[model samples]
Target: MSLASQVGAVATRTFREKLGPEILEVFDKSYKNFTDVQVLSGTHLLNNHDVVVESPTGSGKTLSFVLPLLRILQNSPEIQKNQEIGAIILSPSRELCNQIVSVIKPFGEKLNLSVETVTGGQKVEKNVKMFKNRGVNILVATPGRLFQIIQHEKTLISRCLKSVQLLIIDEADRFNEIQFEDHMREILSCIPKQRRTGLFSATQVKEDDDLVVFGLRNAKQVKCAQERNSAAPSTLKNYFTVCEAEEKTSILLEFIRQKTDKKFLLFFPACNSVRYFQKIFERCLTKRPLFAVHGKCSNSHRAAQIKGFSDSSNGVMISTDVMARGIDISDIDWVIQYDLPKHSSWFVHRAGRTARLNNCHMSRFLDKHEKVKLEEVKVPTHTSLKSEELRQKMIKIQVSDRAILEAGTRAFVSHIESYSKHDCHIICALDDLNICGLANAYALLRLPKMRELTNRKDLDQFERSSIETSEIKYLDPKLEKQRGEIMKEKHEKKVEVLAAKEKKRREKEQRKMKRFGGGRGGRGGNLKKNENLKRKRSEDEDDTENDIRLLKKIKRGKLSKKEIKNVL
Candidate 1:
């Protein structure tokens, strides 16, 4: 009757009896029981019914779909070994796709099912060859990569997909995003309509949403009562503090210093910001290992960094939203949000990274002006450092190196641009941001030229570095030497252009003189032409003077019909 006893009771009825022996064998080692979402979802999917599951983080959403998919594939008689795919799972990001594959792979190995992934940051050719070389019974892919492969190997992949018996779209809410919508539609069209479909997410999907394109036929909607209204798990403790922009980094450093042994995922707004702050945190928090993940990182490098951080018991990862969703990194103690996400819904996703399958905490440092934005979310206020503790330590960072200086400037500019586009514009409005304070927070040597700072009055608070940014030298001698050669080449090109313009001007002048002088036969003839031009000018001047004098005399009553006629 109690919660623990109910879970234990539910445990006996789920996973052990329903799943295949191989799947049950794997689940027995770790999972005591399936979560409510997993239990109900598997029941519906086992009956060959389409399902849309809305559940909270850490609710076993991945396994909810994975269990059914593996069972369906095992029973499917239409699937051909090494020739067709039995199931296709569409995820939003490369990292999430990888996570899905990881969850399914253990069961796959035991059941003799083949699983493979196709996502961006890897060669399309490599992914194409996967279908040719091995039997991919289950394919986990990002929409973009899947669509790309479909375009390149339309004949081959399309043939494999024609035989697909199950379609699972993980994090289905993200598929509605503009970047992935078209790709999802194209992929769905290629999949057969008779197959079972599942849509899963931490957020709720409305009845009239675009995800209906996934072709749910009388799809049973499954909502977990335990965490239906919550985006994060009950174990997550959220604390926030309001501070000036310049004090953000200092406060973050203080937080990290207090918990050096714990792992952290520090969220930034963009890739440039991630790269820039990765360098800063590396120098500042030298004792703690640091990793960076963004869209720009190569597939190998990003995966390697994630593996390194995962292998270590504790470390820091600075990243963009690429690492926000469906990434299962165990033992992460904190999720520090350095900047608000472009969309408020993503706030839940960032905080969801921690408190996953365990107790964890998230601390959000809101800009002073942005404190009001949290009125709806209602995160409790937490203690922050005293005024003295939030001292300006960023100045101690070595920005004399041009690489550091440029990275800081780029990060500042990109952060400003990204801030202006926040979906929660009321709280993260651009007009409220202190450009000068933010630059200081980023440890910028000089304010970057950005539209946000153009013709602004509050910039007086920021002291422009007396050292010219152009004068800063790259730390690498080879790069510095290369830059010098480039500058020299540009200067020489400019000088050549100036000399050519001057030559053109002299030639133009000489041509005009030659045409006039040749018409009058040389120096004497040129002088005669000049005198004739002057005499003609003198006669015209005399005629004008005589007419004026005659008109004046007639006005004085000295009368003359000739004078009146001339005036007329």
Candidate 2:
């Protein structure tokens, strides 16, 4: 199945119109209305120009680069000649690679364009056989897997990459991180210098070195404006509920109950947590069952779980940071960061999963710790988004009207049964990081806890610095007690070893003295042995005294720097 017609042959068509009518028809068929960002970015890519797109998540950023590249490939005579590879697309994970494939594949089949995803999880043998038998027009891949193929499959690399015309790196911020830079650079080095390049990401840092490595020169900077303080989409509603650290799990459960009407994507800290929460959610009467994706899960299992989540109308996709970087799924009503991220910038990507395509923005949920970290996070506001739109959302609450009423009515079940009055109330803690003199306390959180802490009266009782430092201490203790124990144990072992060696040497000396007692072990022989021992002790003491005198002389300026070394 392939289109024999040439695309975008209209007279003096504008850059946006050059996307071709066939693509517009596909967009309409998919119930997707192509946006301004897509048109502008697509036009640049079609003109063999480089672009760095910093659009909000869910703004059709994928197609912005993909469509034009695809259109160019569809019309190229070289592409038609045995479907010689014309474009190479790279993302961080196979899940995203498959998602991008989902969009390009169906439309590609109609255009007779061949797109193949080569990821680390898949078997290279299959890819080798496929590429050997057929030419791939667009090879979407992850860095490591593609590099592996490049090293082993020289024939395939030359066939696909030597003449490649375009390279697209999605989630540019993630790929630019320290972890991916080397491989990204290696991949870049392999590509032709005349290639058109695009780096698309929802979250971007201005000083990222990854951008420079992309070899983007005079690239068009395309961005979609969102009205919010965070780098995430303004449509996203951000909130943090205070509770005991142990209560996080129960709170997440209660949260799911409250949002049963919408879908959810929960982010956990590690693989065990993802599995732990998924198992817990399984026993409950959740509107939809839970699914998990993590490193431990097989590639097929991850793909199945992601597909299950995407295809289902209402369900929870529990996962670790593995799913955080660059994945787009529809109707992810809420993004819950199960734990605070190691880097503040990650919040943008985590929250980006929701409120995609400006669908009423999305909702982001955080606990006390995560919320505090988020407040401390500072990204240089170098975005093209309008400044006026970045008003502070932290000071104000953004929950649904229904949520407010439900809270007042206590519609949801209590997270846990409390038997004791101690540790009763959750507390609101304020943290102000006074970096330079520019520190200002901005975010305020209300913990659902007791009224006061032993007559503290209110939140003002706790100083901001005290609370912030206390949190740091709580999360990461100094380990002073443990360190001292380790040092003491080492010192004792060293002393014991030396004492044993000294005892053994003394015993050996006594044995030698006995062995040297010639011509009958008599009183005279014993007297000689005693004298010898006393003389040896005196000689040792005298040597020690001489060394001490030399040290004193050096301290009293009796020895020069060179003389001191010789004396010691």
Candidate 3:
């Protein structure tokens, strides 16, 4: 039968066996919500050609492509038990891959198909063993670890994955944003082109031609229907605040306190920020259960934290964009952008964490600077910097240290010294001082240096001039001194703050002690009470002995006044 007929047949079977009439109604309503562009693209995907589904977040784009893929997979011929991998889905982040696996696994299991996930931050050997030992027909994995596993055990991956008939890339926009395009392309090269490929993303820009060349060349395009207002859903609210860096912790604590019952996620720009905020939150909200998820966290810790948050009724999750794409937790009431996203796509993904499945709400907090930055930020395109011409250009311009250290090359030398050592590399000659000097000069000029420079050829003259002027500046000692002064001032300020805080803590302890009847000595305190009790005890004992002796003398007086007097 033709692919379309087979898809229809499987879809009918799926509707009858798995989905109820209510679910079908929801699906139909959701399908009708798609724009004409999306409908046409869905038709193309159903017909079994590669396609790129580009739409904004919360446009039902995931279901648009997933349903079609599922229909096709369900209709395809059943593989023998314990066979090779059938379909491979690649996601940009582990959370995303796991989320995709979660979404599809239920349906695959209901259809009696084997589905498994392989993401980074976990034991790769275990996952590989699982895939090999038990059969994994549908494999969901992240790009980096997936490629690493394939490279490490090519035979294992090839044997299990060679038969993959379909490949899906979720969150295709991040491929370029996170600089994973090369890794993704390498994975794509490993898989056969004949396999059905699908790329899906929310917030895809028009300038994404690299995505086209990668796999979306012959693929269909899908756009979501525009809303009445050009705005995102009413559930998503964008808020901006301008505060000093030091006040961020205070603001975060206040926000968390105000939204106690709401399940919130705080997004930070880096792992360090995530950790810092975690400690701050711990100190600020000691009673509330807060969890942090980041790339720096171990797999077990991350998994446990995610699982705990997922299982709990109310908790706060502070994380980087690592939890942006692939994690799915229901009823995430708010998304707080403690730090603005580096890219617009990340902004969308971070917001997408909440308001998933048309539930919950999203709010982004940005500083004034971040808001301005967002206006100019654009999502990167999935393009390769791996061409030979670019490599040659980089190689020609690459510099050596000996040349940079030359007397005339002081500016170049200063620039090189200012930059990270990793950024400067010896491209060509080990011994030629003149070649090194020329390369260093070119580097200082911001011209193509000895390294293989890719894509710099496209820069306009004006842009190149700006780059040259902006990049070739000598390090200013005054500026360095000012920076050091600022750092020292910050340190001194922190010390003062800590000292004040410690004094306050001591005062509070003193107050508590006074209120609780200080030191177990009643009014007199420890040392005074001990001395007073010892003196009183000695006086009491002496008084008692005198009284007893007086009683004895009184008794003896009756016998003889003179004898009593003598005894006294």
TM-score of each: 0.80, 0.59, 0.55
Better of 1 and 3 by lDDT: 1
| Model 3 regions lying over 4 Å from their true place | 1-42, 56-62, 78-82, 130-134, 205-208, 225-235, 311-314, 353-568
lDDT per residue for candidate 1 within 199-263, as digits (tens), equals 88877554555657788888888876353322345456555655667767776777677776899
**Candidate numbers sorted by TM-score from highest down:** 1, 2, 3
Sort the candidates on lDDT, descending order. Answer: 1, 2, 3
Q: Considering summed lDDT, which 10 consecutive residues are worst modelled in model 1?
A: 355-364
Lowest summed lDDT over 10 consecutive residues: which window, candidate 2?
411-420
- When 1 and 2 are scored with TM-score, the better candidate is 1
lDDT of 3 at 311: 74
Residue-level lDDT tens digits of model 2 in 328-396: 675678777654544545667777755211101112232332231222211232222221121122112
User: What is the lDDT, from 0 to 100, of the residue 430 in candidate 2?
Assistant: 15
Question: What stretches of model 1 exceed 4 Å from their correct place?
Answer: 1-16, 80-83, 225-232, 353-398, 451-461, 504-568
